[model samples]
Target: MNFTVLVPARLASTRLPNKPLADIAGLPMIVRVAQRAAQSAASAVVVAADHADIVAACAAHGVRAVLTRGDHATGSDRLAEACALLGLDGADTVVNVQGDEPLIEPALIDACAALLQARGDCVMSTAAHAIDHPRELDNPNVVKVVLDAAGRALYFSRAPIPWWRDGRIASTAAALPSPAPLRHIGLYGYRAGFLRRFPALEAAPLERIESLEQLRVLWHGERIAVHVAAHAPGPGVDTPEDLERVRAIFAAV
Candidate 1:
């Protein structure tokens, strides 16, 4: 579908420094991520890094890599800069694959892209699924998204959305029907032109309060088409314990 996958890798992770280069099975996590994205049958796969070491590592594994400004506020900004550096065409679609998600399902990547292509009016698209656990609903780290019947996001929040007026899950469960409180997947797919235009959107109060960059788009009144993935999203590496868990998962796989 004339698309590319951009894997943004920052070397100095506050939680896990040099995380992109961290080993998974036999390859760096970022390399494995790029390979998985490549499985989407994307026209090209590129690793956008801020450090020379990351670039070298990507090259070592024969993955296309490019250097970008390290000061980007978020990976989306870094991806935009990478798109500019690589001279990516504005008409093409670029998938923002998280570098830490080495086990990301390729079908999810394809699904996100398919939504963007099938519904061209939305400049950006993402995936979501029902939050299976009540504990996850309260965890601020787990972003939540609510979508309209047309599959367009209504809001993204760190707070428990569709808040229970009764103040507890025990009561809330009885009030509502089955299936609810969609969890936002960190993955994104964007038009190359939209990626270039994204950085200009000013931060809104809602985004600042929640610390989610995606909210800026919603606050600005832009529609984000949502795709409901068939499978649960892959794990994201954030802490040392997460790395150990991921290592064990990979070992088992």
Candidate 2:
């Protein structure tokens, strides 16, 4: 079970500039993310940074960091460069952990990696949790995934999926049927070989419509194993308010 956790960190965030350097507790966000990833079953944890400052910040915490091209179209692209820089083999597994997820559970990381190993037919793997709240079912921000009988993702969308025929949406309320929806988590696990080729795959229309990079994999007729996590993942920092919330949570600890 040899695997590496690569945290792709970029300095320029439209919502929160220098987001990777944002402080969570006493450490930078990327440093905190690396620390959490290190706790997982991964053999190594590295921060794939797009800027020198991000690399320096990780170094300050004694974490391994690699500087990647600033113009990478996506985090996956940055990860491919980091893998090549590290000289990883094609069979090696790599987990793409976002730098903003300071509260990410180490178990979830291990689960995704393990799932990819178990599902030889799939090139990638990810995690999801059952959506308990009715509001989340309709919330476009919460990505939903429908899984096949084999636990492979059938489709991923911002819209409520597996739409209940019996249920109806009203002005004040919406009726959701039995069997709660699954909320797709952002974590991903990729084989080093497929990761390198991922960037070259043409962007699918569904991917652009849903703004989900994973959709491209499906559109290209690639299978993605989806593991239903035993527990829900912790919140990730995305905006100023999200940062403050994470800070408060860390301060309490």
Top model number, TM-score: 2
RMSD of 1: 2.0
lDDT by residue for model 2 (114-199), tens: 99999899999999999877788888999999999999999999988878677653224554566778999999999999998889
Q: What is the per-residue lDDT of model 1 for residues 82-160, given as tens digits with 9 covering 90 to 100? A: 8998787566888899999987998898888888888866888999988777777877878888888889999999878
Residue 35 in model 1: shift from native, Å? 1.1
TM-score of each model, paired residue for residue = 0.94, 0.97
Error of 1 at 187 (Å): 0.5
Q: List pairs with backbone clashes in candidate 2.
A: none
Output the worst ten-in-a-row residue range by lDDT, candidate 1: 169-178
Q: Which lDDT value does model 1 have at 12?
A: 94
Native-to-model Cα distance after best TM-score fit, residue 151 in candidate 2, in Å: 0.2
